[model samples]
Target: MTATAHETVRDAGRALGIPDPVTEAFVRLLRPCVYPCLYEQLPEESRKHAGPAARAGGSAHLPVDVVVPAYVPHLVTVDCAAIPTDVLDIDFPADGHVAILAEITDQDAGFAIHVPAGTETVERRPRETEPDALKPCASFPL
Candidate 1:
């Protein structure tokens, strides 16, 4: 059974008992790999550039880990109202273990890069800059 991008990530995550924060990172990673399909499903104006290369083998490609870029704003945002504060408020021992908090803040603080499964890090890069999108593909802004 093939999993849609959203389903693939969700299933793998749930089965392994991945936490909510990690799951959000997975979704961000998935957007780049699957956004082209999403665009095709949208109207033409909504659909702009696709991606750098056609995905190999037509099977799914997903990124496992995302890193927090330096000095960037908003890696992810938490909707405090949505989740049960009782659970999200889970506490850590206060013996100077603040770095973990900082790391979480950093990863959730700015944009992220997602390298697809089976691909090397060097292959992933920022798409070209465009007025319509966050970063456009390399074509001199059409």
Candidate 2:
């Protein structure tokens, strides 16, 4: 029997040592956006530039941090409640991408989506503070 995409993602999360609750939440939140059929079912208002706003709100409340690790993206810290809802009006293309939301330290909380340029998988660890270093613990890929 073939493992469904959702199962595969769940397995990946387990293999990466992500906690069960965080993995489950990530899968739940990602289901609508990752699958085309599910994506199509979303309200029209949600399909337009909702990624950033959703990311901001979700990251602030949840213990998980969403990120695309292959691109080595930098974390963007912001106060979710302080973000204006008008951010949804910014026209940008966000398609065919899925992020992994992992439970990380409070200092590591942030958003980090990037256009993937390589195949390196993101590994989460305690972040070390350095003036010009890339912090890898902020995010990972699905």
Candidate 3:
């Protein structure tokens, strides 16, 4: 029910280990700052099949945030810049991933983040194959 592959990726060079304390520390700082800001895109952006709520709300209402906490770090925007609730979000660089989670709803699903395209990735997780291939998994419905 939690993010297995996601967590596994943290120790890419290693077989199975918790992400380093430094990485965890960064995660602590990063997750809360990003979730609220970026979660709104889940429904529309996900290529996976959307359920009834998405059909009713159109592509704009994917509710994937509820499950993110157990698996991924949640970062709410830290800036005091008065970001509109709609604009609050987290962005993931390549070799890393981010999720903007929605509050728990009847349905739960959200979008994953990485550099849009052709942008430099400053920070990335340790990986065996690629350093910055930040990919996200979907919560397939039961």
Best by TM-score, which number? 2
Across 1-142, the per-residue lDDT of candidate 2 in tens digits comes to 1238668878999999998889878876652222222335568986674443222112212123433332233333232332343434343334322233333456554343332324243433333543433434432211
TM-score of each: 0.21, 0.22, 0.18
- In candidate 1, where is summed lDDT lowest over 10 consecutive residues? 94-103
TM-score between model 2 and native: 0.22
1-142, model 3: which lDDT tens digit per residue? Answer: 1245335444562444544765455444533232222234556655364221211111122133322233222222122222224433443233222223333445553444432333343322223555433333333221
> Which pairs clash in the backbone of model 2?
none
Q: The CA-based lDDT of model 3 is what?
A: 0.32
Cα lDDT, all candidates? 0.34, 0.41, 0.32
In model 3, where is the ten-residue run with the lowest total lDDT? 53-62
By the lDDT metric, which is better: model 2 or model 3? 2
Q: Name the candidate, 1 or 3, with the larger lDDT value.
A: 1
Cα distance off (Å), candidate 3, residue 29 = 2.5
The CA lDDT at 31 in model 1 is 26
